[model samples]
Target: MSTYEIALDSKAREVEWNNAKCDKYDYMISVFCGLSAGIIDAFFVGTPGKGRLGQWTDKTADNMVQKIANMLWTGDKRSSVDGRPKNAPDTLEKAISYLEQSFPVNYDARYGKDLINGNAISGMSPLNHHLLSLAHSPDIIGLLFSIIDQFTGKATFINNGKLIRLVPVKDARNNKVMYMQGTNFESKVFCGVCNWLGHLISDLCGSSSTRKVGKTGRGAGLPIPFYNLFLLMDLGKFDSNSFADIAVKIFEEGYDLRHGAAMAIPVLIEELSIKVIWALKQHCYAKKEWKDCIPSAKHADLRMMLLIGNATLCLVDGIDAAIRTGIKGGNPITFILHLNLVAWARLVMLVFRELKIRYGSIVDQAVGKYLAQIGLNDAYSLKQYYERMNAIDQKLDSVLRDFTFKVEDDYKVFIQSLNYTLNSSLRTPEQGRDVSVAIAKKEGVKSDRIFRSQEELRYWLGEKK
Candidate 1:
């Protein structure tokens, strides 16, 4: 002791802070962090154990039902041992109280007010920036859903009782309630599976010309209307029929979903029902917009990253209608039909990508040379390039103008090709029955595996020509 006059290390300050935080969440650490030291447990340690930790690692199919039940009903309770420290949530009752305190009953009253008042909790990691933990702990599912229910209320501005609106959580910019972004697990599962099946069909039938070939540009994520789709699903309005049928109905209706993209012309065609055609048209239009808004041909790599955000505005009528119709009443065939519609959209995107690539290559080969001749460099900023172009020789100007005309013509070709494909695919018995019958009759004899008989093929094609 006399020889040991060692000074405290500078790193002790960080250690002390970590120790304090660990002490605060000791119970949660014990329940979730396995046998790691308390300091190591403050942040997620991704260990193997029971209770909070078990759900993350245990993937046995048999345990799934029990896991779900636990998430729905179980409460966190810590064990009392000679060596372990006792925290406040020492029993199931206390655990419930602890959870409630941590998550809160009203989102708007607590976190919402803070966000609206410009005092939202800061220091969020970009990747996992969720305010509340919705992972691992099954109790969190119950807690979050319960919070949602508490926040849900009648709209004061319109359709009071008829609409069970979620209370405004953040300050409305133009007086509107902000809804949650991202599709819930239910919708994701449904849509993801449907998407997979659609892809499978594309692979087998070559329905889609290319696989995931587009940049998916800015504003390419699910539309604001799609967010409401999730909200409507959360409301538990859709009927108890098959999930497939519900998905189909939603796609067919198109729900008047918002469309966003750069350059688009509304496609009109007489084929299937007007609603189905409209959905196809919107899909094309939105993709067109996405293609146009994305960075230009020179900066194609920049298009790889997507910036996703949800609309703060919520339409009461949309939510109300979803609840009313979705609660019950949807055709089972709708999902299959919806998949076909999505298939068509996928083809359109692939075709668009091909056109973009082809045109971009042409520009790079021909116009790029002309631009370099006129002192244009790929390294130059768009503004710089534009200014230089304005000062180019009249002959060079004509060449640039001709290049632009070619690009526009290419764009027109892109739109027309997609429109033609859509018309051909969506063509109903009434629109192209004669052609379909001839094609089917010729192909039917070749595929006894698909068509049991010529008669079956006729019914399948909806014609007997």
Candidate 2:
């Protein structure tokens, strides 16, 4: 049997790509020409099914819908992918219980943020839709979304062959995966992807540019943010509409319904419509809490990772807003965070947007170099930025050593790989769109078709020429 149908996945992905030129997405992974956003590296995609294993491998994608409805009937945790082990925690309470057991701390007290605690049971992959699984298990819900997001634009009808490819798990140890750093999926990525990102981050900022062009760097297996976020959106973190809003909106504060990479910016843009600039300034200066959250005399390195913790924390907070709003665009914090997103936080949004537009797509190779240029050209200071980043790198390594003791050997191995990734990715946050475009030509992708019509959605999404 084959199942294929169009269904909303996480809104975050829908929102992000909604404004993307349709030609880029539907045509082939390669046609992008780096005109849009993000690169495609099959190896960097996170674990298949994103913790939600779909059994409809025959392609009819429809098999899982009935199975979704029947989750409580048989309570099977096994994957349809050739006896890969039943991978879900089973039941909403059980999932939450796993989180509790994993973290061994109060969860709900943090206003539903316990899922992100690295040491908690909630760390079952820092996804927000965990609550969506409250009616079932996060694993089940994650699977349902995996089906929709993967098949949506690609599906022709219900129960089609597209279902067979809906979920593609990570190789886990491929060590050559790639991804973006300084974001949430940072620590959770595969080692291969980490190597690419780390190298990109470094080349973008580090002194070596010409020599590394034709050579491949070491592997770390980090997850790809471009694809990872796509999966997150499929699971309902953001929708096509939100993605559109993200493409257009700058950054203020509002009912942040949009998902994708623009969550923090759009909400701040709409909610703080009256005072967008002021609000940006505030969040920029908001105190980062890495020191507060993991306060301990463990090591100078562990405490050091908290250097960029403020920026990462800001992204997390904004993403949280996206999750709570159903990626639709409603919420009071949009009203509250209006007057305070200044300084680095505000700068981060603008810089991030520019980078995405300029060098974010597969066609952009100069992107990283552009970022390095920006860092070097900054009127304020690149020296401090470099120092902080170096310190943060050291700190990250220290913490990795400390936490590996608590998890399984597999997880420990995963963390061990983070050393290079952390060092490579923290190179710089800015890149030139030109540089990104240049480099995109070399790395292979699936196709060369980018839906040019989708560009219209960018205007609606706030992307202007």
Q: By TM-score, who's the top model here? A: 1
lDDT of 2: 0.29
Looking at candidate 2, the ten consecutive residues that score lowest on lDDT are: 37-46
lDDT string, candidate 2, 1-465, tens digits = 223223343343345333433222222221121111111111111112211111111112222222332342245454546332244533322332222222121111111232222222221322221121111111333334323322221111111111121111121233222222232233433332333222222211111221123433211111212212222232222434343223112111111111111223322332233232222322353343332223222222222222223233344444443554454475443322321132134446545654465456644445445756776536435456667779999999989876654444644444544443345454331223223323334334323521124464476578988
RMSD of 2: 31.0
List the global CA lDDT of all models. 0.30, 0.29
TM-score per candidate, chains pooled: 0.19, 0.17
Model 1, range 74-153, lDDT digits (tens) per residue?
Answer: 44343444212244333333333233222222222323233333233322121111112111112334233333433242
TM-score of 2: 0.17
Error of 2 at 299 (Å): 47
